[model samples]
Target: MVSLPSTLERIRTRLILLALFLMPWQTRWIFGTDTLSGGISEFGVLSFFVVEGLIVLAFVLQPFIEHHRDFDGAVTLGWVMMLAMLASVFSASNPHLAMMAWLHVLGAYVLFLNLLNRHVKPKEALFAFTLGLVAPALLGVFQAVTGSSPASTLLGLASHDAMTAGASVIETFSMRWLRAYGSFQHPNVFGGYLAVGLFAVFLFLRWDVSKKARMGAYAVGALLTATLVLTYSRSAWIAFVLSSVLAGWLLFLHHRVELRRVIPLGLIILFVMGFTATLFSNPYVVALEETHPGREVYAYQPVHNLYLLMLSELGVIGTLFVLLWMVLIDRYIFANLPRVGAVGALAIGSALFIIGFFDHYLWSLWPGLALVAFVLAMTLRLSEPGVEKE
Candidate 1:
C-alpha cells in the first residue's frame, strides 16, 4: 500500500482501513469438515471466510508495498515461525486440521508483517478497530438484554437457545440467560473481542482528537464494557482488568531504570497463576470444558493455556523459537509512536501474554487468530518511537 503514488496511497489506506473495519464479520463458505456427531464439527471444517479473503488480498498486495528494513528481527522471527508451523503439520494429531491451523498461522504472520511494513499510525489503527466493534457490540448488548440471539446468516449469527445442550448460557439458582455471542462462535470469543475493543477506545480517547471523536469513543467504550460483562467470560474479564493495570503501571514507570520493576511484578503474577492452575486443575478443567459442548480426550481440546497449546502445537523447539520471537519483537525499533502509544502497545502485549496463560483461542481458533494479528500489528507499529507533540 505504501509504494503507490501519494494519491493512490491515500486511497489504498482507506481501503485497508475498510478491510480492518469489516474484518470481524463471521460470514464464510464451508468447503468440508471431519465427521463429529455425524456432521462436520465447526472447528474441523475447511472454510474460507470473508475475513480470510480480505487478508489474502492484503497478502497478495504485500510484495508491491514499499518497506523499511528496520524490522529485520520481526521479519526473521516470522520466517522462523512459518517454518516451524510447516514442520508441525507432519506430527499434528490430525493432518488436515494441522494444515488448516498452519494456514491461519501463516495468515496471522503475514498480516503482522504487512501492517508493520506499511506503517499504519497507532491512532488510525485504534480508530479502525474500535469502529469495527460498534455493530457487534450493539448486537451483543441486545442479545444480553433480551436473552435472545436471533439467527442471521448474513450477520454470521445462529439462533442461540439457552436450553440447547451446545449453547453458551449463564445459570443462576432461579433463572438462566444466554450469554451474548455477537457474531462470534462463542461468548468467550465475543468477550475477548470486546475486551480489546474497550481498550482501543480507551486509548483513542486519550489522543488529542476532536471533541466529537472523543464522544464517539466514549459511547463505544461504554457499549463494549457493558456487553463484555454480559458475556460472563471470566478469561476476558481478567484479561481486560490486567491489561488496564498493566497499562497504568507501564505509563507510571516508562523510564528505563523504573521499567525493571515490571520484571518482579510479572514473575509474581505468573507464579500465582501457575500455582492456582496446579491447585485447581481438576475442577478448572471441568469448568472450562463445560462452557462448551463437552469434549472427550478422544475428540480432544486445546489446553486452556495458550503457552501449553503452543507447546503442544509447536513442540519444545518451536515453542522456544516462538518465545524468542516475542523477545525479538519487543526489541524492534520504537519509531514515531507517541510515548503513550508505545506504552499502551507494550501493556496490551503483556495482557495478551497473560491471557494466553488462561485461554487458547488466540492460537486455536480462526477469529481469535485474526484478531490477535490485528492487535499485534498495531502494537508492533506503535512500539516504534513517536514522541511528537500534539
Candidate 2:
C-alpha cells in the first residue's frame, strides 16, 4: 500500500515527466509566442530549466520515496570530474554557456540519484522519457517533408524566405533547400536527436511491451531513420549507422529467443549497404567541397577540434579527465548494479557519444548537458533493488 507522501511523490514524478516531455515544444516555442527570454522561443529556454527543476524536486523527495541508494563512489567521482572539466574547458567559448552546461550536468546527476533511489518506476520512466523523443521525431518528419514551415504552420512547407536563407548560409550552402531542424538549431543536431530516439524505440521493441506498442515503436524508429537520411547530414548518417549496429547487437545478444529476428535484420542491412553505395555515387555527395569543412588547413581539426571543444571550453586538463571519468562511471555501475535498465542507459550513452563525434553537444549548456545528467541519474537509480528495469 502507498503512503500519502509516496502518493504525492508519484504525482510529482508524473508532473516532472510531463515537464521533460514538453521541453522540446516549449524550447521551440511551438504552441506559444511568449518565452522566458524575451520574444525568443520558450522551448529552448525551458529545456534546461524544466529538467533542472524536476531534478531538484526529485532530490528533495528522494529520502521520502526511496529506501536505499546505489551510487558507487567511483562513478560519483567521475561525474564530479566531468562537471569540473565542463566549467574549465568551455569557459573560453562563452563562460556563461559553459557554466550553464555544467549546471545541467549537475542537475541530471541529482535527478539520476533520485530516480535510482525510487522516485519513479522504470516502466513509467521509460514510457515518459521515450515519449519526449517520439514526439520530436514525428515533428521532424513533418517539418522536413513540408520544409520547416513556420513555427505556427504545421504543414505545407517552410517559407520561401527561410529556405532562401538556409541555402545562403555558408555552413550549409551546399544544401538545396531547407531541412527540418525541429526545435534544434541545425539539421545535424536533429539527426543526432533522431538517432537516440531510434535506439529507444528499438529497445522498446525487444522488451515485454504489447504487440501494438512494439509495432508502433518499430514504425517510429523507421520513420525517424528515413527522415534523418533526408536531412542529408553526413554526421547524422554516421550516428544512425552506429546506432543501428548497437541496437542489432543488443537484440542479437539473446540469440536463442528468435533466430528469425536476426535473419531479416541482416538482409535489410545488406540492402541498405547496397543502396548507400549507389547513393554515394550520385553527383550530389561527391559535389561537396569538403565533407567536413576546415579540416584541410589543419588536418588536425578532426581530432584537435573535439579535444579543443572539450579542453578549451571545459579546460585542457579537464578534457583528458573525461576518459578516466566515463570509464570509472561505467565500471562502477556495471560492477555493482547489473540491471538491464542500467545497461540500456549505458548503451544509449554510447550511442550519444557516437552522435557527438559529428556534432558538438558538449559545447552547449542545455539539452546535451541535461541528457548526460539524466543518463547518469537513471543508471544509478535503476541499479537499486525493487526497481524493475528495461
Candidate 3:
C-alpha cells in the first residue's frame, strides 16, 4: 500500500516536469483590450492556466495528504510580492489587466519555487530547463542565418517581421542586421532567455558528470551563446559580460577554480566580444542606426529605463514593492553565496539586476519572469546540499 502511494507520487512528479518543459511554448489568445483599441490587451492561455492549476493542486495536496510542510524565506517573499501585486491592482489604470498580470507572476513563482522545487532534484530541473531551451535556441540560429523564420509561424511561435522596413533591426556603422526574435516578442527577451540557458549549461559542465554529458553541455552552451550574440540586444550583451566576470571573480575568490583556468575563459570572452563587434559593423546594422533611433514605447519615445517604466505602469507603491523584492533577492543571494557557488549566485544575480535595468521584460514578459523565478528556485535549492524531499 505504501509502495502504491510512492508510485503515484513519482508519476505526479513526472507530470510536473512535462508541464514545466512545455510552459515556455504555451501560446496565448488575446480576447479584448481594456480600452477601445489601445489599452491593456486581455489574453488567455488555457495550457498555462491548466499547468498552474496542477502545480497549486500538488502544493495543496502535499501538506494534507503527504504531511509535508517546508516553507522558506523565498516562498514567504513570493507571497509578499503577490500581496503587493494585489494592492497595486486597486490603483492600476486597468485593474483587470493588473490582476491578470499578478496571477501570471504568482503562478510562475508557485510553480517553480513551491511545487517543482519539492518534486524534482535541482540538477534534473536544470537539465529539463536546458532541454526546453534547445528548440528555441535552434530556431533563433536558423532565423539569424536565413534572415527569415517561417517555421515560427508553423510552430505557433511568437515572432515579428524581421525584414520589414521599420521592423526590429540593428544598425551599425555600415550595415543593418536583423535581430533574431526566436519564440519571443523581442530579440532582447530572446537574448535574456538564452543567457539563462547558457548559465545552466555552465553549471552542467562544472558538475562531476560523465565526459559525454560534459561535451553535450559544451555544445549547448556554444549554441546558446551564438544565438545570444545574434539577438544583438545591448542589454543582454552587457548583462552576460558583467555576470560572467562577476561569477569568475567569485570563483577565484572562493578558490573553487584555479586562477590559471580563468585565463582561457578570459580569452573566450574577448573572442566573443570581437565577433559581436564584427557583426555590428555590417552594412544593415549601420543603416538601421542611421535611420532608426530604436526608442518606441507604445508609439511614444522609448523609455529604455526599467525603473521609469515600472513607475509609469505600476505607480509609486507598486514600484516600491518591486524594489523591495529586488532587495530581498540580493539579500538571499549574498547570504547564501558560498553555498550556492559563486557561478550560480553571481550569474543569476547579475542577470536579474543588469537586465532589469534596461528592459521591462522582467515585469511584463511571462517567459522572462518565469526564467527569473526558475533561477531563484535553483539558486535556493543549490544552496542546500541534498534533495529537499519530505
Candidate 4:
C-alpha cells in the first residue's frame, strides 16, 4: 500500500465539502475560442468549470463506496426531466449548443439530487456553504465602492467599467454608480445568490455552534447584505424580503398546512413553465447565439420571465416533464408541511420562483443554475427524515 486512506470514501468526503464551498462561490472557468472575438460568445458553451469537474469526479467515485441500491425515486424524476430536455433539442437550430446547455442542466440536477441523498451533517454543510459566500461579498463591495472591476483570466474575472455601455450601474443626477457583480455574469445573479444563500447564515444559527461561529455568521450576513444592496437588483431584494416574510408567517404564525394546500404552488410553476407554449415566440430563439454566426449577439436578451424562457427553449414536451417534476416535488414537500424542513424549503423555492418572474437567469445562465443547485442541496436538509416539526 502507498499509505493512502484505505478507501475512496475519505477522498469522496473531502471532495464533497470542497465542491459545496466552491459551487456557490465565484467560478473559475476558461473558454476556448475559434473565433476572432476570443470566445466571449462561447462563454457558457465550450467552457470548462472547476466546480463541475469536481462534481463529476465525486459522482464517478460514488458507486465504489456504496452497495448496490435501488435508484432514489426523487433523483430518477430529475433524470426523466433531463431526458425530456434532450428530446426537446431534436429541432433546435444548433443541437450542439443545446447539448452543451443540457449538460450544464444535468450537472446542476446531479448536484442537487446527489446532495439530497447524502448523509452530511447540518453544521458542517452549513458552515461550508455560508463561508463560501464571504469572499464574493467582500469582492463585490470593493467593486461597488471603487466603481471599477479589473479583469483576471486566472481568477476568471472580467473587467467592468461603469462608463461602458453594457456595464450594470445605477444612474442618478450625481453619477452613474457601478453595481456589484461579485464574480457573477450579472449583478442580478449576484443579488439572487446573496438573497437565497444569506439564509444559510441564519439557518446555522439553529445549531448550537460556538460564540466565534455565531459572531461570524452575523458578520457574513452583514457583508452579504451590503453587497446585495450595492447590486441594486430589485428582483433579488423583493425575493428575499417576500420569501422571508411568507415563510415566517406560514411556518410560525399559521397552522400546519396539509398537502392539499401546497398543490396550487406546483400548478402555478407548472403553468408558468408551459405558459409560453400557448403563445407565439421567435422561431430561432431556442439557440439564437449559435444560430447567428459572426454577429454581436450578446446584446440580445431572452424573455425576462423564467417560465417564458423555458417554454421558448425547451419546447412543449420538455416543459411538460419539468412541470411534472415540479408537481411531484411540490406534493412531496407540501405533504410534509410543518415537518422538519418543509416550510424552509418552500420559502427558498418561492424566493427563487419570484426571482424567475422578473429575471430569466435561473433558467438561462450557468451561474444562476449553480446558485439553484447549491440552494437546493443546502435546503434539502429540512426534508430529511426525523426533522422535528415546529
Candidate 5:
C-alpha cells in the first residue's frame, strides 16, 4: 500500500499534468484588449492564475518535503526572461497589462521548467500534451465543416462572427471555407498549437511504448494535421513542413536509421503541402499576397515578422533581451542534444523559428509563450538519464 506521503505526491503529479494539458485553451476574462498603438491592458484569466499559483506552491514546498535539487542553463534562462519581462513593463504603453503579461510568463516558467521537468516523466508529459490537443482539434474540424461555432461564455470561447464572405474567408475560387480557430483568438494561433502537437506526437511514436499507445499517437497526429490544414495559416503550414523534415533528418543522424524509413514521413509532408495549395483562395492566403494596411493600434504597416513586432512594441532594448533569452535557451537545449536526442528539439525549434519569421503569435499571445515554455521543459526532461532514447 502507498504511504501517505506517496499518495500526496501522486496527487501533485496529476495536478501538474492537468495544468500542462490546459495551457493552450484561452478560457479567460478579458479586462481589455491591446490597442493598435501598443497599449498594454489588463487581461485576466482565472485558469492562468489558479494553475500558476498551484505550480508556485508546489515548487516552493518541494525542497522541504522531497529534498531534491536540479539546476540547468534552461532554468537560468527562464528566470532571466521573467526578470526581463518585468523590467520591460516600465516602458510599456500599458504598464498594468505588461505586468499581467509578465505574471503569465512567470507562471509558464514555473509550470514547465520547475514543476514539469522535475516531477513528470517524459511519457507522462507526452500523454498530457496529446490529450490537450483533442478538444481543440475536434473543435477546429467542426468549425471548418460548419463555418461557425456557438460562443461559450462559460468557456470564454468566442463565436465566428468575423468569418463572413469578405472578412475572414475568401470567395475567389468559386468556393468558400471557414478557417479553423478552435478556441483561440485567431486561426493561425490554433494552427501554431497543432504544429507543436504534431511534433510531440511524432516524438511519442519513437518511444518504446505499447502498440495501443502508438496507435493512439498516430490518431492524434492525423487529427492535428488535418485541422492544421483547415486553419489556412500559411506560416504554420510552411513551418510544419520544414520542421517535419528537420525532425526526420535529426532522427536519422541520432539513430543511424536507413533513408527508406524517413521517406514515408517526407511523403506525408508533401501530401499536406499539396492539400494546403488547394486552398489558395483563402483570404488569409490572399492577405499574404497583398499588402494590407496595419490595424490602427499597431502603428506600422502590416508585417508578419515576429522580430519586427517585438521591435515595434518592446523597442530595441526589450527586443534584445527577448532575443537573448531565446538564444540562451536554444543553446542550452542543443548543448545537451546528444542526451535528449534531436528529434523533439529540432522539430519544435524549427517550427517556432520558421513560423516566428512569418507570424507574431510567439511575441503577442500568452498561450503561444506558454507552449514554448512547455516544449522546452519537455525537451529538457526527455534528456535526463533513464528516459528513453530514439
Candidate 6:
C-alpha cells in the first residue's frame, strides 16, 4: 500500500506536469480577423457572471472551512466595500443602469477572487498569470514590429473600442506602432496588464526556489518590459517607474539586494525623461492648444481627471473610503512582508497602484478590472500566513 507521503508526492507531480502543459498561456482563447461576427461570437457572447456563480458555490461548499478561514474576514470586508460603492451608484438617476453597472463590477471581483483562490497556488499563480498574458504579449510584439493589427475577427476586439482606436499608435523616431494592446480591448489596458505581469516575473526572479527557474522568470520579465514600452502608454509608463521604486523599497527591507537599488533609479530617470519628451513632442499637444486656450482643457478635462471622476461618482466620503483602503493595503503588506514573503506581493501591489493612476481600475466596472482584482486577491492571500495548502 502507498503511504500518505507517497500519495501526496504523486499528486504533486501530476499537478506540476499539468501546470507545465498549460505554460504557453495563449492556447486558452481564439482570435479572429474581423469585427461583427467575430466580436459578437467571442466578446459579446459569454457571461463572466456565470463563471463567478460556479466558483462562489464551490467556495461555499468546501468541507473544511478552517483550512481557509483566516481569509474569510478579509474577503468579507472587501465585498462590503464593493457593495457600498454599488449602493451609491444605485442612488444615481438611472437605477436600472446603475444596478447593471454595479452588478458587472461585483461579478468581476467575485469571479476574480474565486478563480484565483480555487485555481492558483502562490508558486503557480505567477506562471498561470503569465500564461494569461503570453499570447497578448507576443501578439503585441508582432503588432509593434509589423504595424499589423490583429484581425478583429474572433476575440471581438477592434481598433476603435474607445480605448484602442485614436491613441493606439504613437509616432516615434524608430517608426514604432502604437503599443501592442494584444487581447485587451485597448492599449492602455494592455500596458497595465503587461506591466503587472512583468513585475510578477521580477519578483519571481528574486524569490523562486530553483536557480534554473530564475532564468525563465527573468526572461519573461524582460519580455513584459519590452511589451510595456512598445504599448506607449504614458500613464502606464509613469506608473511602472513609481511602482518599481515603491516595490524595490519594500522588498529591500526584507532581502537587501544590490540590483534593486540600481534598477528602480534607472527606470525612474528613463521614464521621466521619455514621458516628458512625449508630452512636448506630440503634434496633438499643439492641436489641443489650438482648440482649447488652457492646456488644462486638454490635459485635465477628460483624460487626467480620474480622481475627479471618482469624487463625482462615489462622492467625497466614498472616495475617501476607497483611498483609505489603498493605504490599509500598503500598511498590511509592509507589516507582514517577513511572514508572508514580500517579493511577489510587493510587485503585484506596485503594478496595481500604477494601473490605477490613468484608469479607473479600482472601480471594477470593466472586464480587465477583474484581472487586476485577481492579482490583488492572489497577492493578499499569498501575503497571509498558512493560506497555501500542501
Candidate topping lDDT: 1
What TM-score does candidate 4 reach?
A: 0.80
lDDT of 5 by residue, 18-135 (tens): 8668765666555555553554322332234344655666555452232113345545655666676677789877676677767776766666654443456767777787788899
Off by over 4 Å in 6: 1-70, 115-119, 159-167, 171-176, 209-212, 257-305, 316-328, 338-340, 361-365, 386-390
Clashing pairs in 6: 32-153, 32-154, 33-153, 34-152, 34-153, 39-156, 179-230, 179-231
Residues 1-390 of candidate 1: C-alpha lDDT, one tens digit per residue: 555556555555665677678766888887778764466667687777776776667656544555445667667777877897799799877788788878878877766765665545667767787788888878877876677888987766789876677788765434456777988888888878887776676566555678677566655666676677667677787787777776766566554443443333334434543543443223333444555456542233457888887887689988988888777766652443337667667666666776677778888888888777877776766655542232
- Ten residues in sequence with the least summed lDDT for candidate 4: 276-285
Candidate 6 per-residue lDDT over residues 1-390, each given as its tens digit = 888655544454334324322322212232222233334423232233323343344444431222245455555566677867877986776554455556656665554455335334555666666756776777777776666664553454454321344545654343324556776656777777776676666645434357667555655666666677667666677677777677666556755664553464346445644553453344333434555557463142343445666787778777776676556555656666664254457666776665665676445335455555666665665666654332
Q: Given candidate 3, what's the lDDT at residue 202?
A: 67
Candidate 5 Cα outliers beyond 4 Å, as residue runs: 1-8, 30-71, 161-167, 173-175, 254-303, 312-317, 337-340
Error of 2 at 163 (Å): 2.8
Q: Which segments of candidate 3 are over 4 A away from where they belong? A: 1-8, 36-71, 151-154, 171-176, 256-289, 292-302, 340-343, 385-390
Candidate 2 has its poorest 10 consecutive residues by lDDT at 26-35
lDDT of 3 at 219: 65
Judging by lDDT, tell me the better candidate of 1 and 5.
Answer: 1
- Stretches of model 1 off by over 4 angstroms after superposition: 1-12, 36-40, 65-68, 253-302, 333-338, 387-390
Per the 3 Å backbone cut-off, how many clashing residue pairs does candidate 3 have? 14
How many pairs collide in each candidate, listed in order? 9, 17, 14, 1, 3, 8
From the highest TM-score down, the ranking of the candidates is 1, 3, 5, 4, 2, 6
**RMSD value for candidate 1:** 7.7
TM-score of 5: 0.81
Candidates sorted on lDDT, descending: 1, 4, 5, 3, 6, 2
Q: What is the TM-score of each candidate against the true structure?
A: 0.81, 0.71, 0.81, 0.80, 0.81, 0.69
What is candidate 4's lDDT per residue for 250-332, written digit by digit as tens? 75555434333333332443353244223223212232434555655333345688888899888888898888876666666
Q: What tens-digit string does per-residue lDDT give for candidate 3 at 306-375?
A: 6777788767776777677667656655766654354475686678778877877776767766777777
